[model samples]
Target: MSLVFATSNKNKFEEARKIAEGHDLELEHRDVPYVEIQADDVVDVVKPSAQQATELLDSPCFVEDAGLFIEVLNGFPGPYSAYVYKTLQNRGILRLMEGKENRRAEFVSAVGYCEPGYEPRIFKGKVRGTITKESRGSGGFGFDPIFMPDLGEGGTFAEMSTEMKDALSHRGESIEKLVKWYVRNNRADGDRNESDS
Candidate 1:
């Protein structure tokens, strides 16, 4: 089965492709310019984005949105993570945590799947971690330089390989759940049959 991924980021595309391959589905990147709406919650943002992408392409597609929530900041960048990352970067986050002992945070990912004439399905995944005083690693992008997973050593996501990071990443977990839902609901049965033929 083939599904359009509503994103232009090549790294995100590669990761989605890897996950889709594991579920026997083919992921096709669609360069759709989605108007990211400002919403009070993640669900609001994700569902609309998925709907817009599906409507524009007139086909089945999926969109993913993630955010980093800091306990100390009371989720300051909950839905505005991208904006925060762009402006503040890692150094800004580090500065915010300067002299503070409580450095807890979590990465939350929401994956929305939209199909023609069907209601969208949303899947969520979260990974706990702490903000580091200094950025580490150079493997991943975005907040990966300072976002350290709780399970791993005192290194940020940038320090981990793609495989290692995806294996334990919130986005990966969300993708896994989304794939399982698709299979159980037989939403891609037609595509599966076509591929078999």
Candidate 2:
């Protein structure tokens, strides 16, 4: 099976490819920018975008949105994580954690898939960990250097390689869930048609 992920982010696309390979499927990347609405959950934000991308591209596609939710901040920067990363960056985020004890944080990803005739399906994954006091590595983007997963040695996402991070990333997990579900449902090319109003 082959499908396109509605994103130009190389990191995300690459991760999808890796996960797809395990499922005996092919994953490709495409640029499909959509109006990302401010929503309380990542599912709401991704569903519309996924549907719009399928409409524009006329292909089976999925859109992903991931956020960094800090416990100390009362889940702040949850839906606004992208905006916060753009402005505050890693340094500013560390500063916000200065002299703070509760550094628990979770990285959550929601992936929405849309076919022409089917309702968008949302798959979600989450990784719970603590915020590092300082940035650690130079490999990843966004809050990778600060967000550590509770998986192995407790290293920051940036500190891990693409393969290592993909093994445990929220986005990777979500993509895998989608692929598995699609396969179980007997998905095929052109299985669904566009809905007419």
Candidate 3:
């Protein structure tokens, strides 16, 4: 069974597709736009989106929500990371971090899956790190260049290759959980074709 990943981000979908491939699962991308609720937690934001996507597409699907939480700012853009990225961008965030002694932060990802008429199942992943003084590499997207995971060998996410970043990323961890579950529960009954919706 091929499950659809409902998201409008081609970058995110491509990253997820790579991860799913490693687990012998096929993931289809559906650019199913849904309303993201204003919630303090990524999981809360994802659940309704997942349900809404599944309903709209009439298929089993999952939605992911991620955020960058800066300790000094007390999670300034915690649940509004996308909006912040749009309005502030990395430079704006750096401006906010100026003269700050504390650089601690974390990236959190939540994946919510739902089937028709069922409650969404949520999986979460987090990577603690420090915000970079300035953007680093040119890879990845959004805040990747500005966030350095503690486990990423001191390199900002954009500084690493996709495989390297995925190994230590919040989204990678969350998607891994979802893929594992699919391997155990959906593989036996799934189709092997890969396609977009």
Top candidate (lDDT): 3
TM-score: the better of candidates 1 and 3:
3
lDDT (Cα, tens digit) per residue for candidate 1, span 67-128: 89989899877889889988998888889889988889999888888887766778888899
Ranking by TM-score, best first?
A: 3, 2, 1
Q: What tens-digit string does per-residue lDDT give for candidate 2 at 1-197?
A: 78888886787787788888888888878887677899978877987888899898987888889899999989978978989999999999899999999999999999888987677878888889999999999987889999889896778989998888888888878887888877766465554432211
Each model's total of backbone clashes:
2, 0, 2
lDDT of 1 at 73: 90
List TM-score per model, in order: 0.90, 0.91, 0.93
TM-score result, candidate 3: 0.93
Tell me the tens digit of each residue's lDDT in model 3 across 39-137.
998877987898899899987889999999999999989989999999999999999999999999999999988887777888888999999899999
lDDT of each: 0.81, 0.84, 0.88
Error of 2 at 23 (Å): 1.9
Clash pairs, candidate 1, are: 137-158, 137-159
lDDT of candidate 2 vs native? 0.84
Instruction: Point out the higher-scoring one by lDDT: 2 or 3.
Output: 3
For each of the candidates, the C-alpha root-mean-square deviation to the true structure, in angstroms, is 4.9, 4.0, 5.0
